[model samples]
Target: MSHVGKSKILFVDDEEVICSMAAEFLEMQGFIVDTYEDSREAFDAFCRDPDDFDIVITDQVMPKMTGIELLKNIIGIRSAIPRILCTGFSEELNHKDEKEVGIDAFFMKPYRFDDLIGQIKKLV
Candidate 1:
């Protein structure tokens, strides 16, 4: 789905393929996406300029920091910016936990691109 405005998104995933593909897909759908393969780096970038991004989409599992951790840090810095957490099936996260963390949305791996885009449009 094409978004109304050029929403800038920060997408973080340890897997380069997923990160690259998602970034390209979002860009194609009329969003400006910045992708990172390292969660810490992504967090650093976010802290550097939180206002540069309209939304954040991050994968749950990573080497340096988990997606939730990154989101937590982001929350401390800029809670108002919408955050979306995406993960493969994990016992660690339930809907309750996500809600407690205050993320705007949660998506599982292999998510439908259209569905994710739709959620993003609503949030942004």
Candidate 2:
């Protein structure tokens, strides 16, 4: 299966290395991924064309905006866009309940690339 409709994935994280790693792995899986070190910049890219992405994966602990904050912003614009929230703050996040937060999926940090690929595939 060619990841046609499932290609465009956005990865947002404060850490440059994590962003690069995710981008590299996801891209290798035939996904069109763009990574950003800041939510503001990522938001700007998304604002240019929100519909370009099929799925979004963001880290939880960022400088200005956390993953939950990012998710809220994205949902405001594109409600139905599937999202995967990856975080180390899972233990402290009140929105861990997917039903309450309306998240499509959640992946804890240090997650395996293959697992992420599979989950994203299922979501899309």
Candidate 3:
């Protein structure tokens, strides 16, 4: 099912290529996406418009704030928004613990766009 015009996503990653690629792909799929390479900046943007996005997708290993840290701050502001954490360091994550901390989904790095879309569809 196409979420065309139905959802807006806030996506953050420290990697420029990943951010650009994901944003491009998501936009093509008809979902409005705001991409950021800086976690702090992304958090600030989200804070300014907490209700603007339907979902949050973030990379785990960022410079200033980790994905988990960002998600924590996000949920503190608006607990209802669904959060997805993407990371290359799977071993660093404790799935059960992350769920407790407010992550609704996880995407390992180098993931297929189809899988990401499927997870997004599931969440909203």
Q: In model 1, how large is the Cα lDDT of residue 57?
A: 95
Q: Model 3 misses residue 63 by how many Å?
A: 0.5
Could you tell which candidate, 1 or 3, scores higher by lDDT?
3
| Local accuracy of candidate 3 as per-residue lDDT tens digits, 43-62 | 99999989888999999989
Q: Could you give the C-alpha RMSD of every candidate to the true structure, in order shown? A: 2.6, 2.4, 2.4
Which is superior by TM-score, 1 or 2? 1
The runs of at least 3 residues in candidate 3 whose Cα sits more than 4 Å from the true structure, single-residue gaps closed, are: 1-4, 94-97
Give stretches of model 1 more than 4 Å off. 1-3, 94-97
Residue 21 Cα positional deviation in candidate 2, in Å, after optimal superposition: 1.0
Tens-digit lDDT string for candidate 2 (59-98): 8788887778788888889888888888876675774445
The C-alpha lDDT values of all candidates are: 0.87, 0.82, 0.88
Q: Model 3, residue 84: what's the lDDT? A: 91
Q: Supply the TM-score for candidate 1.
A: 0.91
lDDT tens string, model 1, 68-117? 88888888888888889998967767666577569888888889888999
* TM-scores vs. true structure, each candidate: 0.91, 0.89, 0.91
